[model samples]
Target: MHGLVLAALAVLVSLTAAASLNAATIGKANSTNCVMLIGGEIVQGDFEKFVTIGKLLLPGDDGESTRRNTVCLASSGGSLSEGVKFAKYFYDNGIGTVIDDGQECYSACAIMFMMGTATGAEVSFANRKLHVGGKLGFHRPYLRISPGESIDSSAMQIAYDAAFSSALDLIAVANSKSPWSSQPMMKSDLVQRMLQHVGNDMFMIDTVDKVGRWDIEVFGSSEPSLLSEEQAFYACENSLQWQNGLTKGDITYSNVSDGPNGKRRSQSLSKETRQAVYQVEGLASGYAMESCVISRKKGTIFGCGIDEYSDARLGQGDCDHSNFADRSSSLKAISVFNPATKLEDLRTGQAVVAVQSGAARCFVIKGSQITDNEPCLVIHVGDAKVRGRASTITHFVWPSGSKTVLVQSGTSFEINGVSTGKRTVAERGDCYLNSATLNDFCVLTSPN
Candidate 1:
């Protein structure tokens, strides 16, 4: 299993040959009008490279037509910061950038799709791997089934049809010009088109979270949530419309919300489950060896190493040794993000990396990528629990013999009286402390 996981990690977050174009020499403007900036090298000052490309693509002479033909970008996302700058530059300037060639753009390059165009200009994607991910843990809602668990025929039929059509429509829309207008597409056709046209260029929507267009706005989030119904459906295994309207295998936000039976009180995962999610996926190292791979600075929480921190101390660097924190739905299937939040800002449910331990310890921004050497996120999808028909996790912790707790941070817990400092109960995975628990609070547990 370890080997298999490592192998999978290798394939998912590959370290591409780093390359970038020489800075635009500062003074030479190309007459070709539209500049083709091929990120041939792994970009160090990635955004600057895109800015160079942007220079040639200003608004037209009349401020209407594109000043330059267009900027053609080719390369994987080496620097998310740089990629965002490039994308924003194009969007702000009202010019469309193209991802072309056999180049695979991952990471921040996925933002290439975030252009706010009125006409919904043709965002062509071909033979590119837009694998976007970040280090962010996820919260899988509690799920369970009783002895006579079953679905009603009529309800089940409605669910099945909704699911089938939703799947078809989603595929058609993603692949077709306007998915809504294309009606529905066959599963095979959708996959074929995605593989053919998108190749590895665009994101390969895998987990149920990403099935929905809205669930996942960015790659890394605290709790990887299904932004949309599509994401929720596909995320479940053999999804079924239970008698309660909740999919059998799917976990809902309500399950993680404040309730008698939900994850609002504590870390829903058990020790084994936590360990399972945190299992090392792979190992990566840089050839740059002049400086020790591990470096410790005063006031930092942990020693910094190239494995998780950038060898080149260009800016603040990706990983902050003083603080190490990460959250990933890929490893744990928990993506928690808000659409309004910028990639620069971190929000709840998003896994974080920060100073291991220190008064000033804080979660900082570390580019999201499993193979990038930085600490990667391991998603843990907790077992499902059902209530009324909708399934949710029952992560309540109670004292020896007591009830009544609080729902804090969206975790469910059982307490005797008013108690503080709660933790995961034990292996069976029930966190009970029997304190004067009122509102369910989210619980923290040891990481794998």
Candidate 2:
């Protein structure tokens, strides 16, 4: 019996090698602490090799080792069975995954990418990540047969059954809570869409809606950006909805307080100060009355408020600062809004604000002059004292975390006393500080 099982395994390995002409190359990522599975088709041989190396490189059962070691996937996909095996191994080990910018993970590769998990300090979360420029495509699993190969009805049925069984396994893994994170790997709708595409067709997760719905973390996109009047207003409204824990798709916005067809108001303020009193519906029981005060010159949200009708009223009877400070959803909305104005175009003294919630009346500039006191959180762009040096600085206020400052002039800015050149995009965990003031400038890329 042992000899027969060994023989069966040998035959299976031989068949897999013969079928997978272009096997994936698995090795350490260059200049980084990550494992890269690049090119070709995923096969049993490659999967086994990865497991062997992964076990040695990722030996810590405490989850920290797995979190530090990410498997970056860039493949056109190969064997569905092998892909399933890889996914199971990643989930069991609490390994994180990344589809980096300019990379593509399709078909079986997408399956492996979706199943990546990691354990955080307090809770476990889906560590499956997709860069903004990366492409992740999916299609239904199908049996592959050599050209002109003759097969009986029984053999064909068995092959079909195996393919279907693999699909079912994929669904189960997607829906099942991670042993470490206790979070579903992917959304049900994402799986449904994945299976909808047959054979050569592909369902690409290419939009913000799909990305958000699937619970995939996206990075490397432009940030601390500016938005149009319409997009900014929508973001403000969306932030309110998120703070109240309302479903994003359920809420709808209207420019006018009455309805969609209501008459537009002639502005009492200058063109540089845009004001809008919008109505937000699809809340609990009733709708919300909201107002937006924007600085058109700076392309920032100057002030915003939710009225008495808002469900997010935290005893203050209006836009509560606690709600905005409690959640970082608003910062995410700011970063995701498209057709954003460039940061370089912005002038000095112009404030780039994130999300603001307060009880003060929304500011509306009158006739090119400031009328009301600024009620929102503001980060000015000008000369400031940093570590005993007077430098021209621009600061960004994250939702519930520390600030990120951009030094424009004065002293040479060095992260950890090492000059990182003119353009430096800080990583998530990096921290820069002015010892004189103890101001921590940490780069937190992810909104969560």
Candidate 3:
């Protein structure tokens, strides 16, 4: 039985090697002019054909290489060595890769997808897109040994070494930093997750969390409904915050606008901030809005939520009779009143704290004494209360702070305020504020 098993493994390895030498088909895809599809088993000649196609499509004439040239991949995986070579070529030449809708890329093919890059001024993983309907899976590289095969110690050791080398090469490729952007082509977490699964099984990039954490773009689908967006946003936001060592919790959206056809939209844009609000059903607050703010310059998204009853004018009495009457709060504690809530309940001398810009600073809110002493480029206060709620005579006061000079120096910012100075280091797509001025500010430009 052992002899038969060994013979079977030998035959399987030979057949696999022979099959992997055949060139994969590479040609213009029907979907787009710039997209070339690489289908079937990847092998020896595929890399040459890919380079040929890439050169023909992206001739170095007058910066033509900067054009969008994508290689959409569809394969069950073949030669790992060839895959590494192709991935290196893609990275060096800024060639994008994609798994189109309904297609699949696994193992070696998936490695190529992850290392793909796009030609642009800044480092962007947007080119390595995996369509919502497509599948991208990974697993540890393995030898082509038959199950239950009885192999000699030397042969087994050789196979194990080969697999180990492949894995190390993969890690090296993933950790390689881009010459221009200094960002890793692929994150370590992604590579670690890929190596967790055995050769016979796969760890699929099936969840939205996986896709976002890996920074893989998704397309071929319209924006989800508010409910779905709310859930997905929370999950993604939690993941991002956890990764960044930031706190995570339930967010609030204080302002909401009802659009045509029962849809609600909230948008606010300035030199410093761009905010979008989506109305969603809330179990605790009855009616809620999921608010997301994007740093115009940094491209980081800060999201929170707001409940209908948060508005002070829509107090306990009024909320009990409104559409969200079922979720009306019975509590009488004033401490539960958030910055956007209990506005009408504020007394003559009550002090309330509200976040000015991205949690950069908090100011004391007292009736008609609103001050704008801060040197912020933009200060957005959610004034629009719950939809169709009755107006109130009480007006909410805004906060005031100090003037500051913001200077960008590499990945860090130096803020010189009137009384004190502080420095903040930021990662790409992260929002930060100055502790000196209590001004919310984020880096909008990429590091040089």
Candidate 2 per-residue C-alpha lDDT over 246-297 given as tens digits, one digit per residue, 9 for 90 to 100: 2345332222334454432212233322332222222232343554322222
What is the descending lDDT order? 2, 3, 1
- How many clashes (backbone atoms < 3 Å, residues ≥3 apart in a chain or on different chains) does model 2 have? 1
lDDT of each: 0.29, 0.52, 0.48
- Count of residue pairs whose backbone atoms collide, per candidate: 105, 1, 7
lDDT of 1 at 35: 43
What global local distance difference test value does model 2 have?
0.52
Mind giving the per-residue lDDT tens digits that candidate 3 earns over 293-387?
21111222223233333322211222211233232221111111121221222223223233233323222112323122111222222223222
Looking at candidate 3, what is the lDDT of residue 63?
Answer: 46
Residue 245's lDDT in candidate 1:
22
Residue 53 deviation, candidate 3, in Å? 3.8
Which prediction has more favorable TM-score, 1 or 2? 2
Pairs of residues at least 3 apart in sequence or in different chains that clash in candidate 2:
124-181
State which candidate has the highest TM-score. Answer: 2
Report the candidate with higher lDDT, 2 versus 3: 2
